[model samples]
Target: MAISTVEATGARVAVVTGGSGGIGSRTAVRLAEDGLAVVVGYTANRDAADAVVTEITANGGAAVAVRVDVADEQAVAAVFDTAEDRFGGVDVVVHAAARMRLSPLADLDLAVLDDMHRTNIRGTFVVARQAARRLRDGGAVITFSSSVVGLAFPEYGAYSASKGAVEALTLILARELRGRNITVNAVAPGPTATELFLQGKDAGTIARLADQPPLRRLGTPADVAEVVAFLAGPGHWINGQVVRANGGIV
Candidate 1:
């Protein structure tokens, strides 16, 4: 069934999954800067999520940290419930929770693939389903993908495949919400300087990727956060698309 946009009553609110660290954390803070109450969702890092909440509160913004396993439907529902309970309503949902495992197609173990699928693909479905059900009219659902889907980097097959599914879900959900005043989009960041990207790479490998982008520098969390803030705010006209936050690597 198509849900129409509802008139928002008070201050806007957002639920950012995986909001404990990296790009998610920065995006949560950025959304708070945009004057929206934020729900910081985390899977295991309670302290990191708490730090994000503290950062927002210290800045005079409102936020809460909720423990949620994105792959679990019931757990995700509770996260949203916390949002609506803490704030007035859910105006935005940022599905930034994903699991990345890099391995060549032949070398990838089935267990690792399953884990990635559970967290990345299933998690996206769970989060987007909840967002579609609960987000108010004029809401924005921003999902995360990776530029590797296009870059076709070696050993990124599994992670890229999962993110490709995310892209598909983003587009389909946008159409499903026909008359709803909400936007569903995915942000595919390139080789950003996030710990996830930097974990196993040496300096040389990092520099090589940084140079692939015309900008000649790795993206910062803040860089991607600006794009998210735009989609959450004035970029309403851009819908059902994958907005790559890459530095022209394509």
Candidate 2:
């Protein structure tokens, strides 16, 4: 079910891509708590996405789960359509949908590289395009990048390259949308203790990376979500920049 725009007339609306994932889900909830109706967009995990929506609605917030493939223009368009149709107009778009594959560039399978780029690079562009077209005045577009793009960790060639493209486009889009009152930015997180980051990582590897940060711990999904919340809400002056939400690992 959709949240009628009339019921949420003054409330801002948000569309969070990959809302089933750790950071994405937290962002959806955070935005709801900040008084925005949200559209939780997921690729295949409808159950997970629905759970996010249920959590928000159970708390008396308005939210709906939308199924979308970020790389598919039509699917991404539908996500924006849902947000506008349900909650009036979209004011914030968090393009947190991405894929990460680790392999030395020389050893990486061409197909693996292709898959990562398709989702991380092309997918971001598809989402950005729609947000630019549909977002109401003073809206925000937040894309996901990786701190690894700067750290240059081994076996992160494909993933970092894709995020590099995201950062590159973020600045360009911000300029393209000049005078439109929309802020475009990218959030790059480092050493987060999320299911996605923990996968296939041994405890030793995790601990070592965690300690590298000045805070001496891995960043939590909530940590990154707060940054997203800022950009989506009050951080109006922060535009066309990449905010590193990595606990000062850089």
Candidate 3:
């Protein structure tokens, strides 16, 4: 279920990949609050995606839920294509889609590593390429990384590597898009209280994890989404940078 409303201010459209889950959904809603029509792209969980759209619409925001696999080039292209066809042109792209794997290097599953690479690294490039092709002048693109890249924690080696690649890609993409008046940046979140972070952890473990941060608590989806909202809206000078939203954990 996709919902779009007329905007008196002539709303710019944004495409948020992975707009069904915690951080993604929050970012989508926040962008809508910033007065942009949002295309909520999801891989699966169409119901969840549509629910996000419903909530945004109920609040008088414009949004649409579209199914897309970011790792697939054609699907990524189609996401932007549909957004453009529906809302004139896309002006912002926040890439919050990624997969995670937990294992020490010596015991790392090769298939898991490969999947992480495909989804995190290659998927970012695919979506960025589509954004480059479709996003209007003076637009913005925000990509996701993790604070694990800085902390180098055990069992996060492969994930860190994938995000490291993302950092590099974001920098270069920003440079490449300089002439186009588009800003490319990344946001690296740390230990957010989401389904992805809570998976397989006991209450004690989760408490310990939360306590490790200087703020004495894990980051929330809204925390990261606020930063994403800044980058997508008023953060024009913050290009080619990775803003870490980890509560000084790393």
lDDT of 3 by residue, 1-250 (tens): 4655644246888999989998999999999898888999998899899899888888888888899889999988888877877787899999999998889899998998998899899999999998888789989999998889998988889999999999999999999887888889999998899998898889998998899889999999999999998988854688899999998886
TM-score of candidate 3 relative to the true fold:
0.96
Whole-model lDDT values for every prediction? 0.89, 0.89, 0.89
Please write out the lDDT profile of model 2 over residues 116-234, one tens digit for every residue. 89999999999999988888888899999999999999999889999999999999999999998899899999989888889889989988998999999999999999999999995
RMSD of each: 4.9, 1.8, 1.5
The predicted structure with the larger TM-score, 1 or 2, is 2
- For model 1, where is the 10-residue window of minimal lDDT? 1-10
Candidate 1 structure, TM-score to reference: 0.95
lDDT of 1 at 71: 93
State each candidate's clash count. 1, 0, 0
